[model samples]
Target: MVNLIYDKSPIFLQNIFISLKGIQIYRQRYNKVYRKELKILNEENEFNLQKKRFKSFIKYTRKNSPFYSQKLSHLKKEISMSDIELLPMLTKDEIREHVDEIVTRNKGLLPMGTSGTTGKKLIIYSHPYDISRRIAYLDYFKAKHGVKKGMKRASMGGRTFVPEKQKSHIYWRHNYILNQLLFSIYHASNENIIYYIEELNRFKPQSIDGVTTVIYRIAKYINKHSIELTFKPIAIFPTAETLTVTVKSEIEKAFRCKVFDQYSSSEGAPFIVENDKGYYDICPATGYYELERIEGNIYEITVTSFYTTTTPLIRYRIGDAVELFDTLPENYTQSDIKIKRIIGRKNDYLVSNEKGKVYSAILSATVRKTEGNFIECQFIQNKMDEVIINFVIEGVNDKKTIEHSIKELMKVRFSESTEYNVRFVEELESTDGGKTRFIINNLNRELS
Candidate 1:
């Protein structure tokens, strides 16, 4: 009777009903691929196979990729896989400057625009094969948690404004297409949340993915209202932003499910995935990653994606700082490497009050503990005795407690005489299309 009523309902109402059913069918198809991927992940000798694959990719990039070939011309030596570091790390600026030259003039390649946090956008081209590989990687990760393809996926991302009538319906037609209930991050608000939640309950997706900040906001609303949300997703995948411990906890608490963090970028490949054990493991099939230290122990991440043939970003300097749990080996596999933390961008650090000094991970960790829902934080040191802490917090809190905590934390982390002032304000914004930087230091004027 319910099926007959839904089938015979008015066009407007029928569309909603169809969308909800389509989502369920999509999840089932996705789950099958997920299971197959999990088996591959657990296979022995996978690391050795990945290493062999990487070596072959390096050779391919050196020959086909003009950007890499030009850079390697100076090193008049046999280019082995180990010689990857010898190549200069590519940056976003370089890509923008040499956009046409970097991209292979080939058909069946897709172009993607990266909306950087700084409002600077970069258009990158990728081969269709590369896109398929990315899908495979997602499938592999999802399978570990028993997520199926036919299940509906709600994405809290930028592209949700498309009208229901005009938006692509191929996903709905095919159960294996991974049905997406796209919710716009740009429009997330009280009213929007209510509508989104209601629609989501109707759609009942198996999982959700997208920016951590937007997801956190929705989770906050759900928790605040103490709403008994019936749409229990199998997993929540957060990408594009720094997934702090606090945000992760809150999200998990609200959704009552495990939260998986994915570390990826437009220039390179999806590099990291959190396992059931809560440890971030490198994706063996995607690319190779290395950490290079600039000052003291502060490191910058360099990635070389094997699958990026259209515009190979060889030894790409992603500009982000990271702390590794395991030191990379001369001939290492994915299992040999683990990331302890992503320490934000290299530019998002402050100079220490101590002469001839710098701060990175320690400072970020300190500010992260302060009382606020901050999108970004920066320390501005104009003089030896004074420092201004520019921050963006979501709502009201104990300012006195926060200030005192920051001051005490800074004292212990840096020089004692460095008195501080906390600037609490809303709208600590992001680069138009990029992740927010949690820490910024203006003292390094020349560097800025």
Candidate 2:
């Protein structure tokens, strides 16, 4: 069988065999989810079907999950979609504290966890249904960009394929199963980045999928050195971190391809994708999304995954903020959900002593104008008055030039009283799950 060949074949032949098998498997799974999605999509009232699925999910969780049973006992008397919303929103702390009770009949479940960027990591189980549905949606996104399964692709993200300590020759690992050339973010540097460029040029992948930081760094290097790519990718996909305008522009210029931003989490609850129309289109089938307004045009997103029965995330309050749009734009492809833009997390803003609160866009613009040579940056704040700027230097710039530029930029954004510290680093580290955080704030102040 092809599956047997994929498992037992040597590395060289494995890419071909695995590509064939992966296509067949993805096709079967994609059709299953696609058929269901089409049924909901064609309906005159889609929320009516969503409501039914939500009720069934609530019943399944209440009957099997001990944690949900106790939490939803009050609503058991009169179950409805409106009543489900009345239940207390699930928090990451609650999930971490009662992971065992949250899981239901874990016979064929896979354990998973988040990157723990906020100092609280949630551990849960991945349901088989969730995995299949996720693959189907991923295929959908790739199809939109004219990509098919088993295509030669280059990926640079959080996975530690090459060990962090080994930095010299081997900067990449190839996966025969997916026909992918995996570039390690840890090993990307000035002395070693050329090897990554060489491997990418050698593979000539049709698509390059990676975190924004890694992809941006590679793109910046290529542009700076005026090195032309051997082969052009049809599309560039960015995930795992927030995609900024500056990075997106740089990446598009470097690759000479359109960049599609894909947003999802390990929790398997929500899915958002950048469509050809330049909109952050949301998929309604993945989760029931609810928005809580924090300020002007900014709302906190809370979601409940309809497919996650093993460890159901119902009304889970993930700390993410986004611009609000009540309706989708004209000529939009998808339906039922609308998000104007993702404004990073609640902690991405700086609580200035004078300017009230400054969002990531403001800080990003300031840094881009001042320090254009830095490939990547992270703004860290531990207090209201002090800000630390962490940057990975790509060019040979003196310390004083970089420091003075950052200080001048900070003065324009924050008050003159606010202190600035600039730290030059070799590379930024990704979280345990391979996600890179652009902004890290340790203070306990409320997000405005």
Candidate 3:
């Protein structure tokens, strides 16, 4: 009779409800413990201990990781901390070339796919300990702003892979279980924007995290129409792309919260986070980060994660460019470094209709040639024949001259008869996660 009751319809529903509620309570308890542990780790001297741990991690990676071992094969066993650059920088191509060998055979490592914004998706494996450390870092940062556990977090990102026809209440409950509200970036239309706002108001999350473009678009909608959002979030963390001062200002105004810009990549470590003081702080436990110049002041960012075990990326060249500061600030710890701005990826290049290619650096230089601050730019190729340049100009300038110069530059590079369409926008957008995509090739073309 008891078994029959357990298997029955209404009784089963009750059982599920009870189980879910219990899980939520358990999660709250776990978060409390996690916060306590993180509080201890946030102490000043804790960073020094983390550095020692990082050194051991370096030694372990060199010994266990084949990819790092091969790259740093030339280095002496007694290499000092300053000799980190002696290890050859690993490129995206190199990682893709040796994906299988790069990943550890350890079962404890969790494998995840890269966002594939650059091109093809790459597989990355990280240890459980690494994941825990990452979570801890996040907790410590959130604690600084008093964002404790049980506070709702709204994430605007890739679509949840669940069936779309599922009931909204069910989906909402699932997200709530995870302490997150997942907003779809793929559907950022006006209708979806309203829906997102409604959901956000209902959830009343403490923070909003997503692609910068999507967030900016939402903010623009709210501002243009004067939509007064009743619910205010504590913080907005933008990730995945470059967050310009303009975009940051807009997001801060709309969300009514301090915008924190995160400089990180899926391939490497989550290295830097901006504090309340507008200074970028390096995540000491994440990795040993370095800025190497290929030419002059233009530098390539490199990172070697101490927490990674599945695939230790030693001296990995993350392709992005950065402007480095000469001296560290007094307020910042010795491990912390100041990065003026992350320019763009080295591989981010625009291909002309004539089959010639122009890198992002060239595009940036060309924009500068017109004597204007190019906030952000993206090249959209609809077909092989049609190319559109969408960019934002900083100051009052002759749009025609700037457009003409870009066309001339493209023509000089390609040597092909190409039609150039330039759209000068007031502001370029970023994804909700605060990432700016410079060149989006929609021509259904693949780079060989």
lDDT of 3 at 359: 40
Query: What local lDDT score does residue 218 receive in model 2, on the 0 to 100 scale?
Result: 82
Instruction: List model 2 lDDT by residue over 1-448, tens digit each.
Output: 7545444545446446435655665555556655565444445354565667777888888899999889878765546566655877988778877979998776868777553344223567975566766776676678778987679988875543343234348766666657788776545545567788888888899999976766877888899999999888999898777887888999999989999998777777668789887778766656677777778767777888776778888899877777857643333322535677888654666766765555444454455446445556677788987988777766665567878887986775555788888888787645455756666766797732
Give the distance in Å from residue 118's predicted Cα in candidate 1 to where it truly belongs: 3.7
Which digits, one per residue and each the tens of the lDDT, describe model 3 over residues 1-448? Answer: 6434333434335335444664754554445545554655766564575567556766776687676677667777755456665667777677767867776565765666552433223568865455555666776777677676558787766432223333343222224455766665534544457767766778788888877766876886687778889789988887665777878888888888898887767655746778788757777656776765655455666777765667777777666666656543434333556666667543354555433344433343344334334444566666666667776766656576767777875654333477878887775444455765656555555442
Per-candidate alpha-carbon RMSD to the true structure: 13.9, 12.7, 13.8
Error of 1 at 447 (Å): 30
Per-candidate total of colliding backbone pairs: 23, 0, 19
Which candidate should be chosen as best, given TM-score against the real structure?
2
List candidate 2 segments past 4 Å from native. 1-49, 76-80, 164-168, 325-337, 345-448
Considering every candidate listed, which one attains the maximal lDDT? 2
Against the true structure, candidate 2 reaches a TM-score of: 0.68
**Model 3 alpha-carbon miss at residue 320, Å:** 1.2
Please give each candidate's TM-score. 0.64, 0.68, 0.66
